[model samples]
Target: MLTQEQISAYNEDGYVKIEGLFTPDEVEELGSEMIKIIGDWGEETIGWRGPWREKYLAEDEQQATKAVLMHNPHFYSATWGHVMFNEKLVGCVQDLIGSSVQWHHTVLHAKPPERGTPFPMHQDYPFYPHDGLDFVDCLLHLDDTPLESGSLCVVPGSHKDGGLEHIMGPDTAPHLPTDVYHPDKVESIPIPAKAGDVIFFSYCTIHWSNVNRTDKWRRSVRFGYHDSAMRPVGRYEDKVESIPIPAKAGDVIFFSYCTIHWSNVNRTDKWRRSVRFGYHDSAMRPVGRYEDDPYRIDPNNVLEGNTNTIVSGYKTNSEAN
Candidate 1:
């Protein structure tokens, strides 16, 4: 069960980190699995080559990178999801968004030392379009997420104001694109987590990560979930949908779709292994995009010539009412 303080913190601050959420063995298992997957795919050195490898890699390289344990076939198995969706995680979501949550999808984000780039600041709603306000997400640390490794930074309670409008204007320092949103009121909060800690927040929360500058890697696993009322609008892939998928040996973090979030770049020499899952409200319905609208539209569908749709699935949970 979630404590009153936790609930209050989340509501007021837009995000919260729960400590000792996973056992040491579980974290080690997930970390080892990630390392193995990277080795199997011949990506052990991919992180050392620098940040652009993900984009510069050949189609085969990209495919190989995706084939690791984070994207391994095992995750699709019932056994995988069963372990990933544990009682504590499910209970937390129920406390936040009711008992009728649904699983969406998953992705693993690996950051190698000096190979990761700064993830630009952006609201998640702009990436994913749906109705209602039940989108939520979680981040589970597989390693110590220290400040030097580029911990996640967030604009507290930004979710409460709905998604912020951003413009791709001039580049910020370090040649990164600047995301200008509601200024004067923006405050960046660094969220540091130890292994086994889980961070949860609303989909509308504005968040981003810095570049890793340490010798060690900061790895984490993330998952997102929504109430039954939300559904995909426009093309699903183009629309951002969050899901909670099962994994055999990692902590799960679940959140909503409106949550704005991004990961930091890895500057360390070690590998950062993180997995992500997205879920949606079972009741969510798809809506198209409008050019003049102030709210976020499904970028994949709203942008011309892009047509990827969201995939749907139903995972039954006995705890769900």
Candidate 2:
């Protein structure tokens, strides 16, 4: 459990480094388990293929893709599960959480020496959004992390700033705007930790790391947890699969509002338009009353009669057709 002073630090700083949270033997065991598990399931090329590399790195000709990562190790090995639920670790989590907690997920973010990648300044909240702010992640260090070795750093107390907009794109992971939150401009605190140390921080905390210049592996496993009552708000990319419809000009496409759907962006000169109409069962009560929906037709866009009718062109069609 955290001491009063440590608790105060966490409360004020939105994070606190718990030195030697695990023993040396435990850290060594984690390292071994990771190696073995990685041998079983191949690691992924997790290096950012973006401008952050060019902006941060020292222009080394021989910098092989910077990092390797494995996700949800506990699903494959019992050792990870054991360590994830260890009494001491859970106790400290409970200390800050102040109630029953639920295990969210875990990931192993290990950076190899020389070209270990640097993460751009951003909050983890975008990656895993929740309704409440009690969600916290513990970065359990498995190897010594110094400033030169891409140690974790943060804009301390930034969690109190609440969630900020991230520069989300298809090419890159969610990060803060390059011009606004660049590492050179943002004031941050470097958190160099030993093998057994763990840094527990709120998900809203703005954090980033630099390229590992030292010739040693900077290995760490992150375990996230939240209050049992907390609810998650998932991003569309995280849960949805996009499949486009092969609709012709006159074809009408329809689907339930609950269905997850998306459309391809228009790139041609043709003005692709949609006239939508909605209906619901009268017996089924609405969760809330809504007004001023986009269902209305635009008067300016219409040529003459700004009719809301679906078949405005089909005026008085006879039975003979």
Residue-pair clashes per prediction, in order, are 41, 0
Q: Looking at candidate 1, what is the lDDT of residue 165?
A: 56
TM-score of each: 0.59, 0.71
- Name the lDDT value of residue 288 in candidate 2: 25
Candidate 1 structure quality by residue, lDDT tens digits, 1-321: 789899889888888888987799977776677665556652432221232333334454532322111543233333334444678877887788889987554445455554343344455665554676677777778788787676777888788987555433332211112434322235677888898888888878887665565666666656777887788664645756455354455666565776666654343344557777655554544555665774767544433322223354453453232
| Candidate lDDT (C-alpha), each | 0.61, 0.81
| Local error of candidate 2 at residue 234 (angstroms) | 4.1
Residue 197 in model 2: lDDT: 98
TM-score of 1: 0.59
Per-residue lDDT over 1-321 for candidate 2, one digit per residue giving the tens place of the 0 to 100 score = 889999888888989999998998988888899888777885657476565655656666224556777778876677787876788888999999876998888988888887787888989999889889998899999999999999999998899998889977787788888788878998999999999999999999999998787889898999999999987786454645577787788898778988877675453445678898775442233332224545654434423322223333444334213
